[model samples]
Target chain A: MVAVDSHAYASRLRSWHPAEKAGLALATMFIALAAGSSLTEVTIAVLMLVMTVGLAGIPPGFYLRLLALPAVFVLVGAASAGLSVTGPGPGAGADFLVAVSLGNITTGFTAAGLSLATGLLLRSLAAVTCLYFLALTTPMVDVIWLLRRLRVPALLTELLELTYRYIFVLADLASQVRTAQSCRQGYASWSNSCRSLGGLINAVFRKAGWYSRQLAVALAARGYQGQLAVMEAEHGRCPTRAAWLAGLEAGLLVLAWLDRGHYLG
Target chain B: MAETVLLEAREIEFSYPDGTPALGGVSAGIIQGSRVAVLGPNGAGKTTFFLHLNGTLRPRRGEVRLAGERIRYDRAYLRELRRTVGIVFQDPDTQLFSANVAQDVSFGPVNMGLPPAEVREQVRQAMAATGVAHLQDRPTHSLSYGEKKRVALAGVLAMRPRVLICDEPLAFLDPQGQEELIELLEAESRRGTTVVIATHDVNLAYAWADQVLVMAAGKVIGTGRPQEVFQTAGIMQQAGLPTPWILEVYRELERQGWAAGGSPPRRKEELLALIRQAGC
Candidate 1:
């Protein structure tokens, strides 16, 4: 989470309008999910990867690693969808690509099941890449700023602002406590490590509560009147960039429509 | 000379909800446009007393006055008082709520309900004053401790308060950071804003402050110019604070009858000048 957040701030595309990036990501994701075609899904995934790694200038190795994080789940789910069991089969049906017979039952990879699995894998990965494109390019502050402009509730926005800021603080506190515990040999053994983990969690919670109270006092001193009002950063309009983004989205929509059943059969 | 008392606390008493006495009958006056340093040991009610000044924590028994008017706890009055008196808390992490440095600095001004242009001007000026204008786009978590401290100070300064109270402003700062911060505070004071900082550095309080307030046991034990307050042995011992080295060195020179016949030196440079004269 920290890596992604920091990278978002450092992205080359950070200066672009957040709404444009968000709209592009969400629209591409919607196309990938609704098209239900392997060609469209594959195109969307490749396009998003290029946008994030090439256009946004995120390191290619890091981007690949992030995409790999969700690949395991996709592979496992697709494998389940692709495998089939047949009962009382002397020989597996022609639909089976490879069959293994054990007693009266047989397990095999059927063509229809494999096709469904392939489609699921492509669609899920494409959607994930689209989401990552947005996440890697847009800082969370800009998203919250856009939300405020859209008239999102002040309470929710304030909560998001505080939560985003304190996550680093709490993480730092937890790491410091863990280091102290480790130095004291509190985690020398498995049992000891368990005890130390428990203590670290307890300490972090107590410290977080204390931090919140201190934050209240600090806020009060700053003339906070039940609201956290702050100026939104100015992101000047870029019509050329918007035009390019619109053209890209139009291309994706056309591909989704033209390749309606290219791979389904 | 009768100086205008910009902010005063008269026998203010307060206890925590757990019945722990944080302050008892604490009274002190801050002169307008003066550099006042609150010196004390740990848990000497310095922070608690500062909270009262900014109307964050109302005194249980006594009244706090700003410009000779009694402070009221009403929401309207507090809004006015807070606009005039801003506080920079000790921990910049807790004080800086916004991730963006510019946004954090603009919080105080935006809360004052200022027009958008004025708020922008205030934020810009505050960031410029604290030398954090270049860091406006940086994330708060990425800032160094010194940078965070300056950003926090900018946050308070954006309010354009008449009195700026900083709790332990010098703690956790490197020598350079400390020097730069004191210089910034001095500049703010030069602008006719009363600046009060609570710190444990006796040498700093002596050298930089026009008035030194020594607190112990939740009460102000001594309050006067640094020369008079630090010269009183009883107050120094009672507050568990060491005398500034300049004072000790000057007193030894005087005892040896080698010191120049003049007022005692309050700063290292002044003491050095005296030594240079005596050697000549």
Candidate 2:
């Protein structure tokens, strides 16, 4: 994607405040944790997914596509749990065909296995969805600004901002170098690939160092004194509606905690 | 000219850390509110000269004075000098490091220890003046080249420097962007800011600068009005620069026997008026 498109998304995200997005992310995680049954976890995960779709205005398919990549691990764990038995003796084979043994053992899939699989799926889904919502609904700058407001060290913030800026620059340079190398038949042979990779790494490092020096000099020219200031959001004099939504989310979290027998069931 | 010299560089000679000479025996005095253009070709040490203005680079041999006070080797004085003389680099990406545009613009004012409200006001005014108010929330990495350039200018304006130095301010801009920047520079100069631009574009120097200083091999070869400077073909050839287009057009008119040699027109409007008078 172009930088401008990412910037537009970031600008729209900044229009909302960071605290509100944090509240939503926390509420969804709590709800996903509170559900008891596998069915309940599934239902909560679906609801959270729907909420993200509605609030972030992203397509539901996009979330599903991202979740699919991590689902393979959950499936592996689930299959392994279903196949294991507690009593572990050689069980009778149900069928033998063409010198291949097939077995339907006496072992039944336990509620524990089902619950473990469901929990893994739900936890992974909730964590990924919460992070996705955070990225989609809040600009990274707002998150950094919130960190500064919470009194993060100025050096760390400055480092983070510089890291973010240079990461994109490095990524661009890497892609350009790779394209140029491929055009020169460097990737066709292993030795050529190694030499090309080494050259690219060295070039990128030298360019990054030069850019870093130039950035420092430019900053010094503009009176930079090693401190980065936080950006203050003009969030319309204490957004009453956002506060009400936050209160509602907090109330739901409390109710969920009580019903789960962890606090005051 | 003002009786008080706001900035003075006395026989300043500097070499890069690699021991390559960049500026050799350069001396210049900038009066308050003077719009000066340092014109030179590539590798003429134009950017190095600008770095010396704010003491980003200290002279290896000579001295620099601002507001009648020499910039001591102390860090505090260097900081004060930086706060007083703001520089806008040629590339906005180098100047803007903050995540968002407004934060980038506010960085200078905040570093200068302005109050929060005042910093906010400065950001707004700078953005407004540069016509980048709408881009305040946008990330610096996401802006188009033109918008990024404007935001960099806004960043410097937020510092409210008495002297504004731009390095090749119109280097990669299209004609429209160039015109807009020229207008912006003119407006800032009218506000009593001493504007110095280092550029190879003789046309911009002619149209925007009140006084031009031609540099070749780290030395000021000629300093005068644009017409007077352009009159010397030898210097222009040496610097790998051409005379301004308007000046060339006026010369062509004189060659056609349509007009007599006099003061050359520096602005397009002046050339238009001359052409109309010549019945062309």
Candidate 3:
């Protein structure tokens, strides 16, 4: 998670207008979800990967590793969808392409089930790639700023900003406590590890509370009056970049339209 | 003329909600345009006293005065007070709530409701002053400890407060980082801002502070010129503070009749010059 965050900050496209990137990702995602086919989904995924890795300068190895994380869950879900379970009766498994008897039941793979699973997997992955594109290019601060400009409630946006900042703080605190526990041999055994983990959580919780109090004091010292107003460096719209994004999305839309209802194995 | 007191605490007493006394009858006056160091061990109420200066924590038994005016807890008054007194907390993590450096530095100016252009200018100036201008686009969490400390100072400095209070400004910084931070604070002081720092480093307090306030147990045990306060062996021992090396060496030279009878040196160079003159 920390690596992803740092990569976002270091992204070559980080200085690009956040709205442009967000709009491109969201529009592509909408097209993929609405008019999705195997070809269209694959195109969306490829385009996102290119933008995230090639344009944004995210290393391909790291990007593939990140994609692999979601691929694991999607693979499991698609496998379940593809496998068909039928009754033990003689005619129950007639439609199954390949069947195996398991005690009182028969399970097999079916053509339609496999196709449905493939479509589901492709669509989910394409949508995920679109999100990763946005997350890898835009820092959370820019995202919060974009939300603020979109008239999201100030309370919600402020909470998001604070939460994003504190996530790193709490993570660091937790790791430090874990290290201290390990140094004291608190995790020398199974029971000891359990007790040590519990102690780490307790220590982090207490320290989080302490940090909150200190944050309040610090904020108040700076004249914080119920609002976390900050000045963001405005990024003016570049017609060239906007046009490029529009052209890319339009290409994806065309692909989606042509591939409507078309599925491939 | 005597220096005017910019901020004063009149025998202020405070305690936590659970009845642990944090500050007991603490009183000190920060002179305008002077660098003051509040030296104490942990839990000596330096942070609590700083909170009171900015109206973050109201005192239970006394009043805090800013520029001879009594501080009020009303919204307008508190706002005015905070605008005049900015605090950089001990930990940069708590003080910096924004996700990025420029946004964090701009928080104070934005809250002050300055015009966008003016706020931008102030943020730029503050970042430049703290030598963090290049890091303005960096994320807060990605910065090193020293960089974060500078950015934290930049955030407070953007407000252009008259009295800047830093809690443990030198804590957790490398030697080079400490030197850079002190230089920044010195620059701020040179600009006529009353810079106050809370630290436990006896040598730092002696060499850098124009005035020193030594606190032992929620009370100010000594307050005066650094030379006088640190030379007071009884108070230094009471506060659990060691004499600065320069002062100690100078005293040793004097004891051997190798130093002329005059005011003691506050810096290493000054002490060396004293010994050179004695040699002549």
TM-score of chain B of each: 0.98, 0.94, 0.98
Error of 3 at B115 (Å): 0.6
Residue A1 CA displacement from its true place in model 2, Å: 9.9
Fnat, one value per model? 0.89, 0.67, 0.90
Q: Rank the candidates by lDDT, best first.
A: 1, 3, 2
Question: Candidates' DockQ values?
Answer: 0.87, 0.59, 0.83
For B143-171, candidate 3 gives per-residue lDDT tens digits of 99999999999999999999999999998
| Per-model root-mean-square deviation over C-alphas | 1.5, 4.3, 1.9
Compose the digit string of candidate 1's lDDT tens values, residues A126-217. 99999999899988888899889889999999999999999999999999999999999989999999999999999999988999999998
Clashing pairs for model 1 are none
Q: For candidate 1, what is the lDDT?
A: 0.91
Model 1 clashing-pair count:
0
Q: Give the lDDT of residue A247 in candidate 2.
A: 77
lDDT of 3 by residue, A1-265 (tens): 7888789989999888989989998999998888757898988988899989999999999999999998889999998988888775666745777778788788888888788889889989899999999999988888998999999999999999999999999999888888888999999999999999999889889988998998988888788889988886688779998998899889888887887778744
Residues B62-108, model 1: lDDT tens digits: 98999999988889899899889999999999899998999999999
